[model samples]
Target: MSAYVVVELTVKNAVAKDLYSAAAGPIIREFGGEFIAGGAWSALAGVQGHPQGAIIRFPNRDSALGWYNSAAYQATLANRDARMTCSFRLIGN
Candidate 1:
């Protein structure tokens, strides 16, 4: 089964957001994740989201978790933490 990493983040600093992506993107790809969507959206539901949301699909749950736990991704989080709050959820697809 495929796995999806869904993230919602409130960006307090755009500069840090860019830095976060620069560091995290290659690590995600290194673990075989594909970016499905990462951007603002039009809300058509009862619940509204933060300013940013991203969907990344991985080959499986293990791969997704591996990417998330990898040092590269961890570094990105460390840097981003000062400028944003991020939450991630994993769903099987």
Candidate 2:
């Protein structure tokens, strides 16, 4: 089974967000995860949750959870508070 991390976010500081993304990418890869899709979005129906979003795919639920809880990823998130407002959900299939 595969797992995904779906993120809905609105960036407040582009510089900080870029920095965070750069720093987090390698750590995600190290844990067997890769970003499958991301970018601006439009609402076709229902409530528009956020202006931007991304989906990260992992080999399995354990890999997804491992990346999220890893020390390196946690460090990257330390400065994200001033960069964006976001929500992350984990799903498996």
Candidate 3:
């Protein structure tokens, strides 16, 4: 099965968000993940949710979990303190 990590977040600090994305992107790709969407736009319906959202695809559940547990991603987490609040979901298909 293929797995995806979906993230919805609100940015509190632009600098910190940028720093986090910069540091985290490489780690995500290192785990053979691809960003499906990472941007802002009108919701057009229902609850708007967060201003920022992203989806990343991985080969399987293990790859998704591996990226989440990786040392590189853990180091990059320092930039997120109060910078943004996020909710993540792991989906399989």
RMSD to native for every prediction?
Answer: 1.4, 1.0, 1.7
Q: Give all TM-scores, in the order shown.
A: 0.89, 0.94, 0.85
lDDT of 1 by residue, 1-93 (tens): 999998898989999778878878889999999999988857787786677889999999999999989877886776878878878999995
Best by lDDT: 2
Please say which candidate is ahead in TM-score: 2 or 3.
Answer: 2
TM-score of 1: 0.89
Best-to-worst order by lDDT is 2, 1, 3
The residue pairs that clash in candidate 3, if any, are none
- For candidate 3, write residues 1-93 as lDDT tens digits: 889998889999888788888878889899989998888746888997788889999999899899999988877666765679887899995
lDDT values of the candidates? 0.87, 0.91, 0.86
Q: Count steric clashes of candidate 2.
A: 0
Pairs clashing within candidate 2:
none
lDDT at 12 for candidate 2? 95
Task: Point out where model 1 deviates above 4 Å.
Answer: none
Model 3: lowest-lDDT 10 consecutive positions:
74-83
